[model samples]
Structures are given as C-alpha cells and as structure tokens.
Target: MIYREYGQTGKKLSVVGFGGMRFGPDEDYGAQVVQRANSLGINYFDTAPFYCNDRSEDIFGKAFKNMPGQYYVSTKSNVGKESTADQVRWRIENSLKRMGIDKINFFHMWCIMDLNQYDRVMAKGGPYEGALKAKEEGLIDHLVFSTHCKGSDIRKIIEDDVFEGVLLGYNVVNHAFRQEGVQAALENKLGIVTMNPLGGGLIPQHQDYFSLLKEREDETVSQAALRFNAAQEGITVVLAGMGTIEEVEENVKIVDHPLTVSKEKVQEIRSKITESMDMLCTACGYCNKCPQKINIPTYMEAYNLSILKDDQETKHRLNWLREQEKIKEDDAKTDACVACGICEELCTQKLPIIERLKEMSLKY
Candidate 1:
C-alpha cells in the first residue's frame, strides 16, 4: 500500500483509507472487510456514530480485536446533534467504548454545512470546544472536521487554524467545486481526506458515461475514478466506502499500481464535465433538511437518471423508490416544494435545486 504523510501529522496513512459507512447488515462480514483492509496495510479506518444503522463503530471494535497490524481510528460528532462540551465528551467516551480504543486517532466536528454552522461549532461551549477538551484529556489525538461546505467556505474554516485535518466530499465529477479548499489545506499543511471519490456510486453505476476517466483498458471505471482522486495534488487520502472483501481488494490494488494519471488526461476529463454532469446528485443528503419534509436527495438521485437518460427513466426510478418505500407516504412530493430555496443553499455542489424540482414537478 502507498502511504503519505497526512499533512504535518507525522503519521503516514495509507493513500486509500477505509470508509466505514457502507457496511452491510451482517456485522461479522463487516468486521471481516475491515480486517481484510487492515491486513492489506490499510491503517486508516474512519467511522461515525450513525453509519450502518449505528453498527459501524461496533464493527470496527470487532475487527480491531484481532487486527494483525497497527491502525488509526477516526470518528465524529455533529454540532447539531451534540452541541456542548459535556455532550461531546460523553460522545467521545461512548465512541471509545464502542470502538474498544483508548484514544481516537482523529475526531471530527462532523458535517458543517456552511460558515454559519461552522461558527456554531466553534462557539465558546459548542462541539469544537468539546473536541478540544477531549484532545486535552488525550482522548483524541488530532482534532479535524468533516464538511459539505463550499471551497471558499472551507478556505475560511482552514484559516481559523483550529483543525489538524479535513474530510470533504470530493470526486472526479465535483473536483472543481472543492479545489479551493484542497489548495487551502495544502497551503496550511493540514491533512486532507476526500470522501465520495466515486461520487457515491454515481460514477460506477454509469460507467459508460464516465468512461473518459479510464486511462487503461483493463482498469474499471471505479478504479479510474478512484485514481483520479488519489492523483490530485492535495488529497492525502482517497476515502472509499468498502462494504465487502472484493471491494476492499479492488481499492487496494490502485495503491499497488502507479498512482499518477497525466495532468492533460485529468484536464480532458474536467473539460468534458457538462452542465448536466455538474448537476448530477451524489445523494450526499445535505438537502434532507427541507422544511417541507421532502426527500430531496432521493428525488435528486432519481433526477440523475433524467440527466443521464431521459425524464421517462427518472419517472421509472422514482416509481422504484416509491415501491421500495424509500419515499414514504408522509414525505412531501416534488410539487410540494414552496420555492423556499433552502436545499439549493445547503447543496455542496451549488446545484440548481429549485429549478430541478420545478422540472420534476412538471414532468412527474
């Protein structure tokens, strides 16, 4: 496995870190996947409280018991969920207990959506203060943040000089969206870990559309997408959510091969990212806060089919979601959107969410 210094942290982390959010229902299988990644030299394992129905940390604890080598654990606390120092401290202890670890290698102020939320996290007795107290008590080794904020907003957060690292949603499709933040992290010598390197399965699911990312005939679109993120200038880790042993092994193979992709090829791919591609939703769920209680991400994900194919496909996708009960009866439909524009404001990709909702309203 290829390792890089996580900024100035003095610890060399595997370039392909294991994201623990995608584990299946079988916790034993999840534990096996974690152990396999560790055995293959994946030393950085990241989880959060509610990932995998709140079983993610417990799975990591299960795997850590018999881990063959050393590894680092990263977990998080949401400011909206646990806003105070005491609450955060209790969360830290709970995470430590769940993971069976003494000290958290990296603890994040989780999911800052904007500068306003960032300020809330950094308020005198808020989540950041709680993390700081945990760090002082040696419960957390490094204080980092995970965000869905824009690149400029990220630059502002980094300038505060409080976080030792950052976890942001970055991928081949939306690299330009977060480039400024990546550059700022590099400039400040802070650890940079990128999530959604596969666009949350968008790239892989539509491999024909993303075929431009592949440099070699043998490389799958998934590998090409992963390589694109790993080859970027400031990315310290290309975090992939590996659910099975096969996924773990495939991700690790990228590290075994050359990590470099020609800059011209990268630019070629970048230049081809159309307006529709830019609007494609990765289903990150930042827009789930709709006051109308609409399932924005689900609709946007269905909308992705319209971008890739046609409105008929989008309708079919929505039908499937409805049949599967992903869109519940109480959830507001697209027509219910009040043009309040909250989803667009919270969107990390800065997508034209209201416009798209109107389009969906008309079509369906």
Candidate 2:
C-alpha cells in the first residue's frame, strides 16, 4: 500500500488505513485480520471510544497484542463542553488501556458535524482545550475531527487552524469537494481523511455510483471507488471498516495497485453515467426566475439522482421536500416545471423547461 504524511508529524502512514469499528465479539478473528494486514504492510489502524459502544477499541487492543510501536493507532473521544479535564484525561487513559497503547498516534475529537459542535469544543471550558493539554502531556500525537457536514461548516473549522487532521465523507457518490470552497480546503495542508469510502458499503452490497462503467470496468467496484479518493490530492488516507478476512485481502490488494483511474476511462465512465441518467433536463437553468424562487437545479438534480437507488436513506431525504408539500408528492420532481415562459425565453439551449419538469413529475 502507498503511504502518505500524517499531518505535520511527517509519519509516512499507509494510505489504506484500517477502521476498527468492526472489531466485535470475535476479537481473536479481528486480531488475525489486523495481523495479516500488518504483515502485508497496513500500518494505520483507527478506532474510537464510541465505535460499537467501546467494544471496538478493546477488541482492537486484544487483536493487536504485542504489536505496539509497529503500527499507528488512532482513536477519538466524545469529550465536549460538559467534559472536565479530569473526564477527558480519564477517557484517554481508558482508551489506552483498551488499545494496549501508552500513546496514540492520532487522537481525534469525535463526531463534529456542525459549527456549534466546534464552538462547544473550542469553548473556554471545552474538551478541545483538554485535547491540547493531552498532547502537551504526551498522551496524544495529534488532534482531529470526523465531520459530516457541508463545506460551509468545514471551512469554519479549518479557519481555527486547530485541527491536525480532518476526517470527512468523500466518495464518487457526492462529489461535494468539486465545489470551489471545498476545493480550497484541499489546496491547504489540512491532512484530509476519507470516511464512508464505499458510500457505506454501497459498492460492495448494492450498486456503485459508477455502476454505469460495468461495460469498461477493469477493476472491482471497491478498487474504482478507493482509487477515486486516493488519486485526489490532499487525501492522505482512505479508511475502510473491514469486517472479514476476505474483505481485508481484497482491499489490501486494491491499494497495492496504482491509485488512479485513467483519464480516458474517466471520461467514458462520465459519458455512460450521463447517458444512463433518466433526467434529460440537463440543468440548462432556463427557469432561473421562478415566482416561488425555488432553486430549480438543486432540487431537480437531487430528485433525479434519488430515483437511481431504492435505498431508504436516499428516498427519505429526497422525499423530504416533497413530503413537506413544497412540491406536490405526486408532481414533486425536478421535471415538475410550470415553465412560466420566463426561464425558457433566456435559455440559450432552448431546453423545454416546462415539458421536462412535467416529465420529471411523472417519475416520482
């Protein structure tokens, strides 16, 4: 597996880091998996106190017995405004006891997804201060946060210059990083980590976002998805929670290969993807001036993409606006355009906005 820098510490960590959330009642099996992966050269192992209700860290410790100093162990604490210095320190001590390590390579502040979460951590009496104290006392090597919010929220956290690393959801599914603001974060040395690498196992169990590439896909779904992130600049590691030995072997093999999908292949995949898309609206934005002033492109794209999957989560979020009566449940689709003739007049493509929204309405 390729290695990359771990924050400013300059430690060359394996880009395919192992996530310990799956270490469960089968502690011995879990350890075996880690040992096999380590023997093959995966050095970064991440676990957190809250993962699987604290059993994961303990299992990680048991499974990697006597492997101290041979691998990097990363875990996080759920400490916050309510946590005192003593509480935070106690948690770290407990985590060390569970992981069988005196010092952690990366000690992240867990599950921070909003500005308020950051505020709570950076408060005068917050745990973020306690984390800094732990580093001073040699308990932790770095501080980080696993965020699941938009670029707007992430930017707020990066401005603090407080995090040694940033862990966020990055995958081929939601390419939020394509946005200019998200792109800026990569340009800076924030030490990015990708969570939900498989879109929460969508590629393995369900269909990959690039499933349209089946005609030309020379690699496995997981490999294609992983390479997508690893090829991107600023992503040091892509973490995967391997639950079984077979998964460990497959993932390690993928990482051992080149971390890229060829550009020509990428263009072809994009072509198939667009062609497979049932939405022909093309987001021409002819209806830029709506009386309700709804974000036509934003809502419509979300609506079109939602139909691609039968997954409950996708439907739940997609149905949110429709369920709220913003758009009629039946007529509620990106295709549900009244086409008031305003955006149509401005359309350079002369896309039939009203007709397209009408077609979209039929799909939902």
Candidate 3:
C-alpha cells in the first residue's frame, strides 16, 4: 500500500482509508472487515457516531481490540447537532468511549453546508471552540472539516487557516464542481480526503457508462474510480466505505500497482462525462432534512433513471421501491413539498431540488 503525508501533521496515511459507514447488521463481520483492511496495510479508518445504525464505532472498537497493526481512526461531531462547546465536548467524550480509543486521530466539524453554517461553527463558544479545547486537552490530534459547500466557499474556509485537512465529496464525476477546493488544499498544503469516490455508487452501478474511467483492461470500473481519486496530486486519502472483506480487498487493489493516471487521460475521462451524467443523484441523503418529511433521495434516485434510461425505467423503479416497502403509502409525496427550499439549501450538489419535486409531482 502507498502512504502519503497528511498535511504537515507528520503522520503518513494509507492512500486508501476505510470509511466505516456501510457496515452490515453483523458487528462481528464488520470487525472482521476492518481487521482485514488493516492486515492488508490500511492504516486510516473513518467512522461517525450514527453510522451503521449506530453500530459502526462499536464494530471498530471490537476490531481495534485486536488490530493487526498500527492504525489511525477518524470520527466526527456534527456541528448542526452539537453546536455549542459543551455539546461538542460531550460528543467527543462519547465517541472516544464508543470507539474505545483514548484520542481521536482526526475529528471533523462535520458537514458544514455553506459559509453561513461555517460562520456558525466558527462562532465564539461554538463547535470550533470545543474542538480546539479538545485538541489542547489531547483528546484529538488534528482539527479538520467535512463540507458540501461549493469550491469558492471551501476556498474561503481554507483561507482561515483553522483546519489541517478538508474532507469533501469528490470523485471522477464531480471533480469539476470541487476542483477549486482541491486546488486550495493543495496550495495551502492541507491534507485532502475525498469521500464519495464512487459518486456514491453511481459509477459502479452504471459501469458501461463510466467505462471511460478505466485506464487498463483489468481494472473494474470501481477500481478505476478509486484510482482516479487516489491518482490526483492533492488527495491524501481516497475514502471508500467498506462493509465486507471482499469490498476492502477490492478497494485496496487500486494501490497494489502504481496509480499512473495522466492529466491527459483524466481530462479525456472528464470530457466524456455528459451533462446528464452530472445530474445523477449520488444519494448522499443530505436532502433528507425536508420540512415536509418528503423522501427526496428516493425520488431523485428514481429520477436518475429518467436521465440514464427512460421514464418507463423510472416508473418501474418507483414501483419496485413501493413493493419493497422502502416507500410507504403514508409517506409524504413530492406534491407535499411546500417549496420551503430547505432541502435545496442543504444539498451538496446544489441540485434544483424544489424544481425536481415540482416536476415529479406533475409527472409521477
């Protein structure tokens, strides 16, 4: 496995970091998966409190008890949830207890959606103060942030010199949207970790469409996607959510050989991504905070079929979701959206969610 310096922190991190979000119901299995990743030279693991039905930290705790080698664990406290200093300190203590770790290697001010939210996080007696206190107290090693703001806003945040690293949704499909953020991190010599390296499962699900990303014949579309992110100049880690040993092994293979994707090849792949492809919903679930409790992710996922295939395929998907009981009759429909615009405000992709809901209401 290849390692990169995490900013100026003096820590070398594995290029492929384990994201502890997609664990299955079996905690033992999750622990096994994490151990396998560590055994295979994965040294960086990221998890959060509510991941995997709140069992992610427990699984990591189990694995850490018998970890095969040295590792670094990254976790988060959502500023929106734990806004104040006291609340954040409690969150840090709770996370440490859950993970059975004395200190968090990286603790993020999680999910700042825009400059307004960033200001709130940095306000006096706010989340940043709490995290700063934790760092001074030796509870965390480095301070970082995970964000969904645009490249410009990200650049503004980086300019503050408050964080050692930045984690954001970056992938082969959405690189253009976040390119400014990546460049800023590089310029400032900040550690850059990219989440959603698979476009939130979109690229692999439609491998044929994204086949252009593969630089070699043996590379699966997923590996190609992982390689695309790891090959970038500024990316310190390519974070992939691994639930099983197989997934861990598959992702680790991208680092087996040297990542040799050229700027020309990257540009070629970027050119092939059509405008409609840009519109595909990554299903990050940021839009789930709808005031009317509308299932925006599900609807947008179904709408992806309208872009990728046809309206018939979209309707079929909605029907399947209904029959599978993922969408219930009692759930609020798209029409129920009051156009409060909250979902659009929180959306990482800055999609026209209100417009999409209006369109879905009439058509679906």
Candidate 4:
C-alpha cells in the first residue's frame, strides 16, 4: 500500500486505512480480512465504540494481537454533553481494554457535529480534558475528532488548532461543499482522514455516472473514488470499511498506485455527476424546517438511488430509510409533504420537492 506523511506527526500512514466497522457475524472471516489487509501493507486500522454494534474493538483486539506495534490503531469515544470527566476516562480505559492494547495510537473525541459540540468538549471536566489526561498518561498518542458539520463550520473548528487530526466525510460527490474543511485542516497542519470517500457506495452502484473519473481500463469506480481522495493535496488517509477479503484486495490494488485524477478531470467528472441526476439535492439542509419536519435531503438521496441506479442494494435504501425513522403510527414523514411547495421556494437548486415526494409516495 502507498503511505503518506500523517501531517506534523512525522508518521507514515497507509493511504488506504482499514475501517474496522464492517466486520462480520463470523469472527474468523473478520480476522481473515484484517490479515489480508495487513498482508497488502495497509498499516492504519480505525475503529470506534459505536461501530458494528460495539463489537469492532473486541474483534480488532484479537485480530491484531499476534502483530503488536505493526499497525497504527485508532478508535473513538461517543461520550458527549452529559458525560463527566470520570465517564470520559472510563471510555478511554474501556477502549484500551477492548482493543487489548496498552496504548492507543490515535484516540478521538468522537463525532463532534458543530461548534456547540466543540464548546462542550472544551468545557471544564469534559472529554477533551479526559483525552488530554489519557495522552499524558501514555494511553493515547494523539488527540483527534470526527465531525459531520458542513465545510464552513469544520473550517471554524480546525482554526481552534487543538486536534492532531480530523476525521470527516469528504466523498467524490460532496467534495465541492467539503473542500473548505479539508483546506482548513491542511492550513492547520492537521492530518486529514477522509471517510465515505465513495459517498457511502453511491459511486460504485452508479458507475456509468462516474465513468469520467475512471483513469484506466482496469480502474473500478471504487478505485477511482479512493484515488480521488488520496490524490488531494492534504489527505493523509482514505478510510474504507471493508467487510470481505475481496474488498481488502481490491482497495489495496488501488492504493498500491498513487494515480489520481487531475483538477480538470475531477471537474469533468463532477459535471457529469451533476448532469446525470434528474433532480439532485446537495443536502444543504434548506428544507429541514418543513412543517412536517421531514428529512428532505435524505429522502432525495433515496429518490436519487431509485431514479439513477439499477442495483438492488441502492433501491433497497428506501426501505432502510423508512425503518430508520422514529414516528407514531400516524406521524408525518415524506408522505406528509402536503404539496405546499414551501421547500422548493427555499431550495437553492429549486428541486421539485412536491413532485419528488410524490414519486417516493408512489414507489415506497
């Protein structure tokens, strides 16, 4: 695997870091996947307490036992607003125990979504203090954070200059909106680890739309996505959650080479991606204040899957979204849009909200 300098830490991390979130029901298969990844020279493994129903750490501990100090292990804590310093410390100790490691190479403050979350972390006796204490105690080497905030807010957070690195979602599709965050992380000399580089499997399922990014005949859409992120100016690692050995092998092949799409090529493919969609939503959250409180962007994404792709997995996302919502038997959802066209009035894209919700109503 190709390696890059992890910011100012002076450590080399594999470009294709193995995300330990998708390990399977079978323990042996999980180990085999990790073993295959290690064989392929993927030296960075990232996991979190919330992944795979909290079993990732336990599996990683066993899978990584025989090869101590051979890999850079990273994990996160989801502790937040309500957590005390004692709970924060317990989270670190528990993660160490679960990973069966004396020291965590990278221990993150977990998913800090906004400036409010940042304030909470910096509060007296908060998780940030706990993480710092752990670092001083030799339990962790670096402090990091992951965020789902938009690029502009992310830039604001990175300007604090507190973290050694950051984990954020920056995929081929949303890079235009997220590039600012990546720029800020780079400006601060913080290592950037990109998650969802494939837009959560969107590129692979809709390969025809991403054909402009395929640099070589042998390059898969997945490879193009990984290379796209790794080729960026400041990206230290492109994290992929591989569930199978085949996935490990395929990703390793892509990371073995440093071929990346140029800025011209990226713009070319991005235009294609934008043009191929019937009614795209950039998910800017403009429609979030709906009278029904509907998650319009998510539904739009599901609608994009239904309209743009031919795969069963992508089509099934509608059902996944349905089951993910929490509502009373008669509560409002996509079907409750009421065709007021209010969201369209505010949408920068001017997406036909009522029409798309009608499509979803008919389909789902």
Candidate 5:
C-alpha cells in the first residue's frame, strides 16, 4: 500500500497501479480483485476500450458502482486523422459511461508511436482538439499521451509541452535505451508511468537473465521487475497488467516494501545477460511494424528461451509462438521473411533478424 508523488501533480498514487487490460471472464472474481486492490490502497486504475476486446471497461463498471471517487480512473481515446472533436468527446463520454464515473482523472491520446501520429492528432479538427475541449468542459482533469515510439522520438513527444504526463514502455532490458525519455519527462516535470515493467512478460520468460534483481530468497522474477522499475529515479508508478488475484497479491507484496537496486548492480546484471545470450530482444515491439507481420518479438523471445532455458520451456514458448495470429495480408511464418531488411533498420538493438529467422525456420 505504499505510494509515491506523481511528479509535481500533488497527487500521491499507488506505486503498483492496476492495469485493466487482463481482467478475466468471471465477473465476481474481477470485482473481488478490484476490491482487494482498493483495500491494499491501489488508487490508480488504467484501461482502454481496445483491451480485453472491450470487456475491461465493463469490469470496472461493475467494480466501481459504490466506490466512486475512492480511486483514480485513467483511460485513452483511440482516434484517427478523420476523427472530429465530437468523436473524441464521444470516446471520453463513452469511457465514463462504461466505467460508471463522472470524470476521468487522466485521459490519454493512446498508442501514439511517432511524430507523424502526433502531428495528425494535434492537427486541425483532430482528436487533440476534442480532448482539449473535453478538458475545458471538466470531463477530464489532465491531458496525457501513451507511446510505443523509439527512445529518441520519446523526448520529441515530451517537448511538445501539450501533455501533463506520459506512459511509455520501460523495463530492465530496455532501460538504457529508455533513460533519455525518462530524463526528458523528469526535466518537464511530467508524471512518468511505465508500462511493461516486465518487458511484456519477457523478463519472466528469461528468468536467468535478470538474476541480479533477485535480492531476496522469496522474491520472484516479476517481483524483481516491479522493484527495479519502482526504484527508478523519475518513475511515478509501474503498471503491471494482472489477470488473477494471485498476481495482484504478488505485486502488492513487492510494492508494499519495494526494494531498491543500485545502478552498478543493474549494469552488472546487464553485462551478465549480454554474456549469456547472443540475441537480446527487449520485446519493445518497435520492429513489429513489419510489412509481413512476422511476430518478431514473440519468436525472438522463444528463441532466447530455447537457448537460455531448458528444452521444455523452449518448447512451451515455441508452441505459444505458433498459436499467435498472423496478418491477413500474407501467410506469416519464420521462413516467410523476404529479408527486405526494414525490420533490421528499425530494430533498436540491431538484432540479426533475417539470420535468426533463417535459423528458426528449421524448427517449424
């Protein structure tokens, strides 16, 4: 139930914020999870309509009926170039209705990946105007943005000075790449909420890579991730998408007395990880915008596990990789890569993707 100052906003938020993307099908179970989170002093809950095929908001609707104003609700607007201000306001109003809340504490422009998208949103008659209008009308308290852009582009987004805060991907493997953005947010006094603190499950998948984070005998890989992110200098909160009550309790325990790891220790861990594995995919999803839609991150994770962990774990990940849906434009497979080299260019870590794909193709 520990809290931290959310930048300079005068708001104290739970160090472990609830991400509403993974709520299960059981209504009562979801409600109890929310209730338990509330009892543990988790006040910040974030969701978007696209998450869980839009059922996540409905779960919140049921969970927040009598507990109004006891928590801070955060949601996003998914709009495009043709979207008007009314449409943006409608998105906000719809989220409010679904969550049974009067107003949202933070409303974000969701999934903005680059300056092109940012310009489109801020352009005339775009969703940005609609969000501003909603804020003026008291529907939303603050304006924010969520991005999956490269680390270099992240500071550019912050420099626009439009958003009060930002949500971006930051985890153990990608900390060095993301540190620039974190520093910029700190400079701007923006509230920094990091998503994928576990590298979108990559940390759990490669437990041996993050051994230095395990300070206590009872600590799990995920707990180490939560502590690592929570201890970062400018981070406001670390959001972990928990589907079950067990996940919630585990996260609560870690954040209740979150451990702080030193920079030297972190660098030593990174060095060891570098020595242990030939491929390093932080699962940032930057290279996921492939024309062929090859699911590079997932396969790369499986590949790393295959080399680092036991064969059974590797087989499990490979099976998981096989089950993932591919883009309809082409038959997606490891061997399907045309070697256009677009992914390599976009890759932050400069992974030898084509070579890896060639290697992985034999397994299929």
Candidate 6:
C-alpha cells in the first residue's frame, strides 16, 4: 500500500488503512481480520471502545496478541466527563484489556460535535484533562479527535492546538469541502485522515455520486470512491472498511496504483450525493429503534434509493443494517405512521419522519 506522513509526526502510514468495525463472523473474527490486514501491509487499524459493544476491541486484541510492534493500533474513548470519573477509567481500561495492549498509538477523544460540547471538554479537570492524563502515563501516544460536523465546530477544537491529529468521516461523495473543519484540518496541517472512503460502503451506489456518471454502468462504484477520496490533498490516510479478505486485497492493489478523481467529477459527485441523501442519513444506523414499530429512516432510504432508484447500493447498506439488528422485519412503513410524533421525539435529527415517510412511501 502507498504511504503518507501523518501530520508532523513523520510517521508514514498506508493510504488505505483497515477499519476494525466491519469484521464479521466467528467468535475470534476480530483477531483474524486484523492479522490478515497486518499481513497485507495494513499498518494502521482503528477501533473504539463502543464498537460492537466493545467485543470489537476484544477481537482486535486477540488478532494482534503475538504480532510485532510494527503495525500501529488506535482506539477511542467515549467517556466525556458527561459520565462519572469511574466511567472514564472504566472506558479506557476496558479498551486496554480488550485490545490486550499497553498503549494506543493514537487515542481519539471520539467524535466531538458542537461548540457547547467542545467547551465542556476544555474546562478544568474535564474530559480533555482526563485524556491528557492518559497520554502523560504513556497509555496513549498521540492525542486526536474525530467529527461529523461542519468547519466552525472543528475550528473551535483546533484553536486550542492541543490535539495531535483529527479524524473525520470524509469521502469523495461527501467531500464537505465547504465545511470549515476540512479547511482547518488542511490549513493547520493536522493529521487529516478520512473515514467512509467508500461513502460509508455504499459500494453499489457510486454511480449516483457523479451526475455525469449516473447512467454509466461500466465503472465500479467502489473504485471511483476510493480514488476520489484518496486523491485529495491533506489526507494522511483513507480508512477503508475491508470486511472480507478479498476486499482487503483489492484496497491494497488500489493503494499500490494511486489515482484521483478530477475537480469536475468531485463537484458532480458532491451535487449528486447531496441531491440523493435527502435526510443526510448515510445509513450510519445512528437513528435506530422507533418504539412504535417504525423503520423510519431506513424505510425512506429504501423508498428513495432502493424501491425508487437503483436498489443495489441501498440493498448493500440495508443488508449490513439487518445484520446489526437495526432493521426489524416487517416494521411499520410510512403509511403505517399515524402522525403520533412518538418517533420524532426519539429521533436525534428530530426528522419530521411520520409525515415525510408517508410522502416518500407514496412517491418512491
């Protein structure tokens, strides 16, 4: 795989790193996946304490138990001083135990969103302080953070200049170039690695990213996305979710022969993706479990991308969601919603789903 320097650390990492979240099957699959990735020159692997309810860490730990120190491992903490101090250490130690590792090459504070949340962590003896304590004790080698927000929020964090790197879900499909966070990461020379390089693995739907390519059937969507996201400047690593052994190999092949998406293609993809993702739901499975037996977002997603347009990509995403228990079989459809607004109250996006679902269900 191709390598790039991670910020000012002078540490070179593969352009395509293995993401630990999608490793599947068997009890020890995590270790199996990591070892395979390591064998393929994937020096970087990212896992979090909350991934797979922490089982992901356990699996990752088992995978690299006897491996050399060449590969770099990174984990994240979700203890945000929003919890008790005990919860803070519990989260960190639990990751350590699960990974069976002494130190994380990079310890991200996880994904911080708004300025209010940012301010809370910056306060005296706050979560940031706790992370620093871990770093001082050699538990974490570098301090980093991740985000799904826009530029202003990201700028707020970099203003402190306390972090060594930043991780965000960037892709050719949703370049989010207009976002201040992307600009700041580039301007500040922070370790700006990208996640969801395949646009959160909407592998079958790459054609939709570019309006010009919407009707193109020859190109593989995955290849287009990987090239597009990896070609940009300032991206240290482009994280790929290589669940299967073959997928990992494909990514390695691409990194060896690096290429990029053009600016016109980038703009085309951005516009198409923006037009496609009506609810801004990348099917991340964040808005889950409508108590009234409603599938809410997924149903709308299905109506638009699957039932309405090409079902290939939507089906791929929904299949993964189904495996995660996020998709309840035969759950309430848009037509089933009675405007009770119960699902809306539970929705983090506060999406007017009960109404939109009806309209979408009818249209798509």
- Please tell me which predicted candidate would have the highest TM-score against the true structure: 1
Q: After superposing candidate 3, which stretches have Cα over 4 Å from the reference?
A: 274-278, 322-340, 358-364
Across 1-364, the per-residue lDDT of candidate 2 in tens digits comes to: 6789865767888888888877656767877877777876789888887676657887778766855246888888764423666667777888888888789878877766457766777777577787789889898988877765557667777777788787776666544332332454565566777777765554555455556433334667777677777877778888888777887887787665677767776677555543344322234353466664655654544444454564354446557866777556454345435566765554322345566556545644
What overall lDDT goes with each candidate model?
Answer: 0.90, 0.67, 0.90, 0.78, 0.80, 0.67
User: In candidate 1, which residue ranges exceed 4 Å CA deviation?
Assistant: 274-277, 319-333
Better structure of 1 and 5 per lDDT: 1
TM-score for each predicted model, relative to the true structure: 0.94, 0.73, 0.92, 0.83, 0.87, 0.78
Task: Give the lDDT of residue 58 in candidate 2.
Answer: 76
Candidate 4, 142-246: lDDT as tens digits: 898887766777888788788889998777776766778899999989999998887666678777877767888888888988888888889999999999999
lDDT of prediction 6: 0.67
In candidate 3, clashing pairs total 0
Ten-residue region with minimum lDDT total, candidate 5: 321-330
Flag the better candidate by TM-score, 1 or 3: 1
**Residues 261-294, model 6: lDDT tens digits:** 6667666655555445543335555445665667
lDDT of 1 by residue, 137-201 (tens): 89999999999888889999999999999999998778887889999999999999999998888
| Number of backbone collisions per candidate | 0, 4, 0, 0, 0, 4
Q: Is candidate 2 or candidate 6 better by TM-score?
A: 6
Reference-based lDDT, residue 195, model 3: 96
